[model samples]
Target chain A: MTLSVALGPDTQEGTRTGTAEATDSLTAPDIPWNLVIWNDPVNLMSYVSYVFQSYFGYSESKANKLMMEVHRKGRSIVAHGSKEQVERHAVAMHGFGLWATVEKASGGPGGNSGKSGGPGQGKGKRG
Target chain B: MLQPEERAGQDPLAALIGLDMDVAEPTDRAVKRLLPNVVKDDGAASLEFRQLTERSLRETKIGALRAAALDLDKDEIVLTPEGAKHWSMALNDVRLVLAERLDIRDEEDAEHVHLMQDWSQAEDVESYLALVYNFATWLQESLVQAMLQSLETRR
Candidate 1:
């Protein structure tokens, strides 16, 4: 699939003093964000795999592998890209009724090391 | 319930949601697919999720499908913003169910249906299910596109 790689608007420039500046040199763009799909009781496995294939243009085996990862691991990083792209992917996943979220790639800025909530975070209907 | 002739006046969403019980209650494979486990490897959590949300999810899907089946007799379907959202969700639910029944796991499974020469030669159940699966996929894709278009216009 064609990925849109425009520079993300919400790039946070990390500022540090002394030794801290030497260690934390990761740029916002370098710290990729992930679009995650959480396991849900409603969506079918095949359907989830199909979405991964159709939306991301993943090969059938890759899509199936990712679907299985979500099924087994409770969540999977379905895409890695700029925050804007990741957020867009999350929205599309939500449009398909899958539980989705966007988060700073593990060990990114703000030290928020886990999946952060996106627009459609809750377990309910789309607004 | 309206007679076949009176269905033109009936709400399209209602008509879709009011599918005969037999049509709604698909085989075990479809049922398992429609209601998949949320917490894998944790039987208790999976059961809990099912206990808490299965009925409500089913009810919500049925409600949305009913709302989407609004004006079946009309040649063109024009949905309000709210109707479009409901239609999208309902169509996804229908496609999920149909895909499961057809045993469509990957591109290969989908290709089998696409490559069929004639449904007349297939078993009655297989042919009927293939038709339903294809129809549901078309409807779901159309609704998703419409919803995306609506989103673009609002932005």
Candidate 2:
């Protein structure tokens, strides 16, 4: 049977997590890590974009841009953070059933641009 | 499709405790798709990560599945934000398992499967699975579109 979209009340308070600020002081070299989302035939395009917006609190446009990149390029680094942070995001993505992997940002295919700001750090844009 | 492993004459407490003495990567392709390696090209590291996190991950997915199942009984299901999240996850997992069973390895395979829409055409197990997979995909797309609309309204 074809399922219809019947949305219930949207009453849950949107909990936007605070974006982690850039930290300059570090004793140990905290090389950046990336949370890469791979394209799959199973996951819906709209669902993937929604995940980016809701979970990372990215803006709609940014989420769509990244989602399109994943669809076209086969993969996209959706978020950047410290190794631990990106690992946590990877776990969350897996829970959503998206194919996600974590790797060092510097060595990955999309090499780090030295611009540390990325959606994975939860850049404070809601909706 | 997701069920707790049942071994005869084994301790039932193992499931409750959420610990297994020996855990290896799942042999089934469908199971592997659900719980994939987090790190690319690093078997040892991925295995270590799986050992640390796979149990909790299984529990989380199961929890979502159970919640979605309960809502299925309602005459007109009205979901809260949390309920929608669970439903989305459950439906997505279901689709992943179906896709694997259908052997939909690429876009071409998915397109071929999409051709099996009519119930009358389902003469084999493979065709039946394809229809089910397509249904789940359509349902997920609708839910996601609703979610995106809500997000827009919130902005």
DockQ of 2: 0.34
State the lDDT of candidate 1 residue by residue for B53-114, as single tens digits: 44445566666777877655569977787777677667676765666666766555766764
Tell me which residue pairs clash in candidate 2: none
True lDDT of residue B59, candidate 1: 60
User: Which predicted model would earn the best lDDT?
Assistant: 2
What tens-digit string does per-residue lDDT give for candidate 2 at B44-102? 66676675567778888999999999999999999998899999999999998998898
Which regions of candidate 1 are displaced past 4 Å? A1-75, A78-127, B1-27, B73-76, B117-123
TM-score of chain B of 1: 0.68
> How would you encode candidate 2's per-residue C-alpha lDDT over A14-90 as one tens digit per residue?
53222342233211245567789999887877788889999999877667777777877899888877766887788
DockQ of each: 0.10, 0.34
Cα error, candidate 1, residue A36 (Å):
5.2
Residue pairs clashing in model 1 are B11-B70, B12-B69, B12-B70, B13-B66, B13-B67, B13-B68, B13-B69, B13-B70, B14-B66
Q: Which ten residues in a row have the lowest lDDT in candidate 2 chain A?
A: A1-10
TM-score, B chain alone, candidates in order = 0.68, 0.87
